[model samples]
Target: MIPLLFALATTVAGPATPVDPTIARFDRCAALAKADPAKAAAEADAWRLGGGGLPARMCLGLAYAAQERFGPAAVAFEQAAREAEIQRDGRAATLWVQAGNAALADGDAGKARGFLDRALALPVLSSAQRGEAFLDHARAQVAVGYLDAARTDIDQALALVPRDPMAWLLSATLARRQSEGPRAAKDIAEAARLAPDEAAIAYEEGNVASLLGKPEEARAAWARAAGRDADSPAGRAAAMALAGKADAPPAP
Candidate 1:
């Protein structure tokens, strides 16, 4: 699993103006969210005091989501969406994506679908944005047990960005769920090749090894994953696999 960074590169950057005090505070909150949730929460309060804008609210929402404070995250995202609408800056599409992500994090699949559907309907998004939206939409589909639809959406996302490791990972997981073992293995291998440093790829490799009845190989793969990022999803998965081994009776 990856570190779940907010992918700040997704935001458009231009010539740097003198940083607004509020935006600067928001950035501080974002940084603290990765290392100290309590400090991030304090910074978020300061950001609100500085007069929250759409970007500020979104950052706060991301911080909350990262800390698993889903309810407050949803509220912040919702406020950002409304502000985008009022501003008529054509940022509604982006806001919808943010809202969808927050809703998904909150385990509100219906709300996620509603926001994602609106985002997909927007015609002005760049190709990369569309690809990201498709990938996230596929995730919502998978969460609701719409495996086939998730597969199709992932295929579309991959077509748009063939080199995206996450797209390949999503496709691989969907294939595995569908019992297409060979296809899943191929996809996971491709993703691993593309992102050799990503712990998630190794975790997926461990899963494939387990599915193929190679327990020792699985353990080795998961160990590699756990070594890369102790706080990542891959590390948690590896720990789970280790626990399972401890619970199983010794082979006769």
Candidate 2:
């Protein structure tokens, strides 16, 4: 998965074109938002009220997202997207994608799906951005139980950004969920190769091993996951999985 920093900074640069005033200001505000979200949000909101336009609103959304106030962030980003759309600005696509990601973070899968669908319909996104949009769309689909659709979108994401370990991880997870043990094992192996230190990937690798009835491999993978970061969610899960297996009764 894209870290919060990458997710927020994605709106900062792209398009090969020279940076304009709006983008400059957006960049400045995004930096401040990461450092001081409450202050940034206040300033951005005041700027919006003073007719600072797209950049201000985008900054407000950035500040909210930095604070993990994802519901408000989604609202702010969607409003900015609408503003950009009316003016025929290409940034509208990125804004919509940001809104979708925020909504997904807010646990509103249906709303996130709607926003992502809008983002994908726009023509201005770069190929990489389109791949990320597809990846997030798959997350939305997964949240809403649209597994088949999520699978298709993940496949598209993999095609576009095969180097992205997160995409491979998600594909492996979906394959495991669908009970395709060999495919899950293969995908997770690729993910591990790309991101050997990621606790999440190690934990998933353990899961794939377990699914394939390779308890020794599962135990080793889970041990590696816990060793990487015992405090992270995946690490904790891996530790628990190892514990449960250790306590299981022996077969007759």
Candidate 3:
């Protein structure tokens, strides 16, 4: 699964093209998804059958995803991706990546991996899309216990998005999982530098410090994390860590 910390700043950049009327309509439907998912879904479905094309199907998928109906979202995105492929549209890579994300949300990591691999193979994608795809692929690798491969994927992601806090966070997490304390500490420090107010980064900083046997550093980091938002799960976990608990539960 992609960590919430990593997902926080990620947004899909829209395709680079002049907004035609159809795409404008699709965008409107996509915007309505969060506020009125049912209505948006119904509209998208109706549009799909009335020459609405791949964009309408993609909009329908987004509506389903907004409702947390990930299974249907994945199916819709897959269909849209296939249609895009048939038309030789550059947008197929984006659709495939969206399919991968929905499959991940639906708890089908294998399918997610397949979709992401296809996305990565596509010749057309912006650097941002390729970087995000690598991150998503790394998540699938992590799910299947392929830590080393995940590390490689994350490195690729970082190369494309060097300034992204989430990239550094993921790199830190992968390093920690591999017991590379110094690397984890360095990467997490970079993440904290990029997003100083992120409680999750502080929490992970504490974890890395603790793993390196720096009690004072860990305690200080945890205290900062706890103070960020005391009611949050990350804050609660930070509090626990600062208390020197040996077996604290994982943070959200």
Candidate 4:
């Protein structure tokens, strides 16, 4: 779940403008996360040399997060949020989202909620921003055991961006948590439809199938997911589940 926060941050883009060195470094770090986190951290360190602006600080926060340094990540994100506030840019909403995620990763649901609330208060955010905020809020709600609130937020996010694979994945996650197997399956299926190349959706579908007692279906879905992104958490979970049932074999 904490990793999902990282995923959310990776998907969001900042405003288009002259390349702010901090944001350029942040983008580079984001790109490196898929290939080489060590390189990403090095880039973030370089960005830090220019000395802590909102984007640079946020990149540092994410770099720490990628390294599983949650405490420092949260602190960096908090500082970034303060800086963004001082700058009073609407884009600061994105920083708030990142800070909320860092807080969530650190197991501070109260802090997560506070940061998410600030993100939601941003005036006239674009649909993408609103969707991201709702997604982060949904994740925070889930952390706090507010199942109903999580459902509402995720649903709203999906409505705002029906084609977003991550939104559907979040919906599937919420449904699974509620023990609504059919709904989870539906959400995962939609995610697969929207993002045919995304292995995560296939892995989610596998989980839904397994939960619904369709072991053969789960096996097939997991296999497809594994073929797409062998390193993703979804792929790992599917592989682990399959491995546990290796002796018994998948049901026909």
Which prediction has the highest TM-score against the true structure?
2
Candidate 1's residue-wise lDDT over 1-252, tens digit each?
112334222333566745565446656767887778766766775666677676667677767877888767767777876777788757677777877877887888778878888878878667878888888888888888787888888888888888888888788777767768798789989999899888877877777767767789878878887788858867777766766743111100
- TM-score for every candidate vs. truth? 0.72, 0.88, 0.85, 0.71
Cα RMSD for candidates in order: 5.9, 5.6, 5.5, 6.9
Q: Which candidate comes out best when scored by lDDT?
A: 2
Task: Give the per-residue lDDT digits (tens) of candidate 3, residues 1-252.
Answer: 222111111244587744567757876888778689999999999999998988789888888988999999989989998998998877787888888999988888889989999999997877877998899998888887788889999999999888889889888878887889989999999999999998878888888887898878888888898999888887988888777664233411
* CA deviation > 4 Å runs, candidate 3: 1-21, 231-233, 243-252
List the candidates ranked by TM-score, beginning with the highest.
Answer: 2, 3, 1, 4
**How close to the true structure is residue 100 of candidate 3, measured as C-alpha lDDT?**
90
Error of 3 at 214 (Å): 1.5
Residue 146 miss distance in model 1 (angstroms): 1.3
Give the Cα lDDT of each candidate.
0.73, 0.85, 0.82, 0.72
Candidate 2 weakest ten by summed lDDT: 1-10
Model 2: per-residue Cα lDDT over 138-206, one tens digit each? 989988888889999999998989999988999999888888998888998999999989998998888
Q: Determine which window of 10 residues in candidate 4 has minimal summed lDDT.
A: 1-10
Off by over 4 Å in 2: 1-25, 245-252
> What is the alpha-carbon RMSD of candidate 1 to the true structure?
5.9
